[model samples]
Every structure is written in C-alpha cells, then in structure tokens.
Target: MNDRRIPGPLRRRPAAASLAAVALVALAATACSGKAEEEGGGGGGADGVATDIGVSDSTITLGALTDMTGPYATLGASVTQAQQLWADQTNDAGGICGRDVELVVRDHGYDAEQAVSAYSETSSQVLAYSQFIGSAYVNTVRERIDGQDQVLVLPQAWSADLLGSEYIQMVGSTYDLETINAIDFLAEEFGLGEGDTLGHVYFEGAYGENALAGSRHAAEELGLSVAEQRIAPTDEDMTAQVRALAGDGVDAIVVSAGPRQAASVAGVAAAAGLEVPIIGNNSAFAPQLLDTGAGPALLANYYVASPALPIGAEEGTPAELSAAYAEAYPDDQLDNGVAAGYSAISLLGQALEAACEAEDLTREGVAQAMLAMTEADNGFGIAHDFSDPAAPSSTESYILRPDADTPGGLTVLGDPFTSPLTDSYTRE
Candidate 1:
C-alpha cells in the first residue's frame, strides 16, 4: 500500500499491544447509543492523543447509516458486513493508536424519514460515518453532517451535488464523471456521433439526475441529441421507457437506475427489437441479474461504467477481498458492494492512523489528515487524490460487460479511461 502518512505532527506513541490492552481494560459500555459505547472523553488518556466526541480513552466509534429491506437491501447488507469485516481485521491488528475501532450501524430501509431519524439518533455518538448510503437521503442530512456535527462521512452513493464538502468525502468518481466516461466508451465502440440520439433512463433523484447531467454534457460535446426518460426508483418495469426510446430511433441507451431497472430495460429493448448498445452506471447492475430471463439480453449488448474494479476480478485488491469475504461470509455471495464498503472503511482507517500519528484524534484533526492525502490508493484500481474537495477523487472509470461465467458476473472489457470532455465540464 502507498504510504498514506502525509507528514503530519508526530510524536512517540505507546506500543499497539500495550494500547490495545489498556483500551480493553478501560472500555466501558454506553446505554443510549445502539453501537456507540464511548461518549467522548476530554483530555488525554495514558497516551497523550487528543480526543473528542465518539472517542473514549480506549475506543473510537464510527457510524454506518445504510439501507436494508429497501431498494438496495442486498447491497446494503453486503456493504455493512464488509465494514464489519474491516473492523474485525483492524481490531485484530491491535487497533489504531491503541484504540479499538467500533462501528455503529443502522438500517434506514432507504426511506427519507427513516434515514434522517437514524442519523439524528446516532450523530452524537460517532466520530464519523463510515458508510452513508443513498444520494438523495444523504443530501437531506448534508447540513447537519458538515455544519452541525462537523463529521467526516464516506457515503456509498456518489452524486456531484455532494462534492465540495470538507466533511463529506467521496471515495471514487461521481455519477456525472462516470457517465461521461460511459458515453465516451459507447461512442468509441459504436460510431455514435453527430445527429445521433442517446436515450437516458434514470431515476428521479440526485443519483439519476447527476448521471443525466453527464449524458447531456456528452451529448453536447459529441453533437448528439438526448432522449430523456425519467422514472421513479419504485418503477422497475422498463417496457414503456424502452419502447419510447426505440420509437425515437435512439442509437444507444443509458440506464442509471437499479439492477432490476437495468435488466428490464435490456430485456424490453431486445424484445422490442431496439438492437442498441446499452450502457449503465456502476450501481445499475448486480451479479444476480444473470440468472434471470433478461440475462442473455444484458450479456449480449449491455456495458457498465464503474469507478472501481468489480469484486469478481482476479487481481489486485478485488482478488484478496473476494477470498477473504468468501471465507468470512460463507453463505453470502460476492458483489461490488463488498469491495466498495471495504475501500471506504480502509480509507477512513488511513485517516485515523494519520490523525493518531499527528497526536490529534479529534474530528477536526482527522478531517485535516484526510485532506492531506493528495494521492490515496487502496489497491482499488484507482489512485484517488482527495486534495480537491470540489473535484472527484478520480475521473477514470472501468468499462465492464456482464458474463455468466465470471467470478463476480462481470469482466473488464478494456483498460480504464477518462473522457476528454470531462475536463471542460463543470460540476455544480
């Protein structure tokens, strides 16, 4: 791994073994917070590290506001479990700064009200949020997360609207950038240029809108017309949308919704004889879709754009994580969520260790430590730079296609690339 330390203030600290022992002995249980045991102790412990909320003498509590029993329930469960696996590994390795890392997880069920309530319930107890899923839901709590609590959050969803916040750190490329790269790939592969129309099927929210923004930008740059079809997250059937796009004589289609929506669109398009190359954002496809009736259609024409390598890949971090996850979760299947979730916590852990070395484990200190990381690479196929808050960590995206025989049901179709148009485009 790259040396994540960024020349912060340093001091001689206690041994990891000794610190773990001390923290274990000094650790006490908290009653109100579901998973947060520490209520933020002031002053230094046996070690002279500065502490604040969510950090007791012995433990550092982090939060995960996730979706369960909702649209992304499968991904949510896998991501939460991956985070738990990282926590276990960190604690087993003697913890960070002699403190055991504790994760406080809550399922929001992808409901707006429930998401806010979950955050309100656990905001005071966590030093930062390791996993905050859902783009629109996270937008609702942006003010509180950055202004009121001043906590660093690594959200699972990537929306351009979430950019330019010191407290909210996105790990990979945003939806707009990913979409731009996807459009570039499609144009390269299918000779789509001036006068051609590209169909966009997206959800009616931040995630979908941001991706739509990318498609629009690409359309302008390539002189292609855009056929827009906006649908709600609850709208899974794509028969109408696909028929409309086909009637418009679109050269291609971009699906920025869920895996179910992607499947429906591909199936409906094939059945309708649309016969166009279909593109999707990272979150649009799941491995399980291969077993459905739409599987052949998806494999025949569909391609996906992603900021990270698929968990099914046989090299780098994905390979190692796949083996460990398979061992840790024998009953569960592998997915991209596992890699994404592990990467988020791993990046946060990097910041925590940097803060500990700087002798400032407070929220502000940790935030600064993360900001100091100009080149953050966790072996996730992208070398992310967190220096610019307004820009995405990385603009490069992997172009992948679904395969029934692949380990994670997706295979790398080509080398990762970034669109030149992305440089001229501005993020809001």
Candidate 2:
C-alpha cells in the first residue's frame, strides 16, 4: 500500500474529466426528452427485449455516483477502480447476457446537493445506479429513486433505515449488526466478559446511533456497562472525548465514525496513557492511517470489524480476487474498500444475469432478481443470502487486527463471527 496521501490531481484525471464533460453535454441535449431510449433486440426472453433507459442492442449503461473529490476520496477511488475492473472483465467475457456494460462514473464530492444534481442529469441515461457512495447523499436522493423506480447499489451499510427502500440493495451487514459482532469478538479475545465497561465514541447520525444500539444491546446481554460521547463528523480532535472515557475507566472503546476520527481517538487515548483496546466499525478504519503520525497508536490498539474478509485472506476466493486485482491495477492498494466495490459489482452482476435469464431486463426485473437471490458468492469467503426480503444481505463479520504483512494493513483474527443477535436484527 502507498504511504502517501492521495493527491488532489489524481482525483481529476483527464480521461475522467473529459468523460464527465461529455456526459453533461449529452444530458443537456436530451434534458427535454424526459424519456428513456427504447432500443430493442437483446438476450432477454421475448418480453425481455431491452427497452430500458440505458439498455440497447449491444450495451447496458450504469451510473456510479461517487465521492471522487470529497473527504472519502481515497476510498471512493478504490471503489471506482474496482467497479471499472469488474465492468471491463464482464465486457471481455461477451458482456452480461450479450450486451456490453457501460459504466458512467461521476463525482458527487460527498455533498448531498451535488449527488442529487448528478443523479438528475444521469438518471434518464442509465438503467440503474451501480454505486451511491455516502449515506447523506443516498438519503438526499432516496425518495427520488423510489419514485423513479430505479434500483441502486449502496456503498454504505451503516443504517437499517436504508432497508426500507425497496429499490436499494445493501451489500453487507448493517452497522448495528457489525458492532454486535465486534463486541462479541472483543469480549472473547480479551477475556473481559461480564462487568467490563465499554466506551463508545461516535458521530451523531444514523451510522453512529445504529452502532450504539448494538453496543447497548451487548452491554445488556453480557452484563457490561456502557458510556458514550457523540461528536460531529467535522470534529478532528478527540482529546476531550478520550479523556472523558479514560476518566470513566472504560475497559474498551468502540468507535463508529470515519478514519480521521478513529485516528484521533486512538492517538488521543494513547497520549493520555490509556491502554485499553479501541475497536472500530468498518467505516472507522482505513489502511491510509498506517501512513499517518498516528500509525503507532492505531497499530497498537485499533481493531476493525468488517462484514467481508480481508482481500488477502489466505487460500480462498478472497486471495484469488486480490491476486486478480493486483494484476489489473498493480500500483493501486488492495484494501477493504476495493473488496467492497468488487463484491457490490459481483452481486449486481448476479442479478443482471438472473434478469437476463428471466427475459425481464427492466429495472423492476433487476430488483426482483436481486430479491430472489438465495445466496451470492462475493468472490470472498463469505456468501450472502438474500432470499428473505426482510433480512439483511449479510449478518456475520470478521474481526481484523492490524498487520504490516497484509495488503490492507489488517488480517483476520479468526473465522468470521456470528452472534444470536444477527438472526433477530431488523430495521427499527
């Protein structure tokens, strides 16, 4: 993995810039049409003729609304690269059900308004959204998607609320479930069972609150005490929060924010001479942290709970996928984000293939295909079952500890963990 921070210029590569410009002009020219193209003749059944917005005789267009220039740009870049790789491979294999896949990537800058504007411009030209990067931006356009009958593959699985959207397919466990599994792993790993105090440092929103719900549930179930401090996402320094947790003498700290916040909490706690382990939700940790001044602190204390196995997990589909990615993009870092992007696209491909088989290649058909999926192989160790509409795609997760030898700066602690809480968890 590269230790250097992602350069700003890398976000605006000339090829992508030109693609965006052309897409914008094309969008403007067809803005008044307000109707999708109806090209026919494809691999679907008689009724499965391609007539949707982005489908044609030889191509199927999909849109990716990502944060290429925002706070999560590094993660977004990895995701976009992975998606492109999947599309390229699919096209090379005679395309999905005979039509080539065309992926249109757009930068939303992690801003709600920008995401909405970008969606509006590209909505009429695409069959579905292959990626919607941020929670806030997804919320901004959630209603629009439902109204337009468009299916979306969401980047964040932090909120159960997203499950309410019939058109959205979440690729992994919800934040709450991930946290529950994390607590279960930590309790067993550290031999600190009943009566231990757990501290939660979180951002104040659906993501944080959902994670807190799991912590509180675990506390009740395991006879542990809980303390919490909520902060804004913009808050960089967490010295005061760590001080408070330290003062409370919490046995462990659970972070439900982003990478910067994770770095801050770990660094601050270490600076305060507190030594309890600091566990982070999937979104909380990034490999880039290893390159920062806080690397030592994170390496010493930070553990991550993720729904998928690390890309480099030994002798499995994951390792194979990682090898393929390295061959495709040798210079790029192989991290959880890249794995996530690949999994999302892989899941979408399954649905697309199913839709093609059923001869119903419309947006509704894709949603139906996804909902009908009994299980999906992510090209990783885990397989998600989506047969139950009310259940999440995944409910188990692996506990990862930082390791210098791993591509993602982390290695799986053991086999993936699943608690009874997973089976019963549902959207509130």
Cα lDDT tens digits for candidate 1, 1-428: 11221222111111111122222222221122323324454566578898878887779999999987888887888899999999998999999999899999999898776776788788778888999988777767665566656888898988888777888888888898889889988878898999999999999878998899899999999999999999998998999998889889999999999889999999999988889999999888888888899999999999989888888888788888888898999998787788889988998999999999999998888998989898887878888877777766777888989988876788887666777777667654
TM-scores for every predicted model? 0.90, 0.86
lDDT of each: 0.82, 0.74
Query: Candidate 1 vs. truth: CA RMSD?
Result: 9.4
User: Poorest 10 consecutive residues of model 1 by lDDT?
Assistant: 9-18
- Model 1 spans > 4 angstroms off: 1-39
lDDT measured at residue 393 in model 2 versus the true structure, 0 to 100 = 76
What local lDDT does model 2 show for residue 267?
Answer: 92
Return the lDDT, model 1, position 26: 20
lDDT of 2 by residue, 1-428 (tens): 11121111101011001123234443453343344433322344334564556777778888888877876677788788888888988999999878899988899886655776777677777777778876555655555566643655555445655665557777777778789888877777786568889999987766788789888888877888998999987788998999999989899999998788899999988888999888999878778888888889999988999888777688565677777788999987777777778878888888889888887777777878888887688666677766554456777777888776788788987666566644444334
Clashing pairs in 2: 45-359
The number of the candidate with the highest lDDT is 1
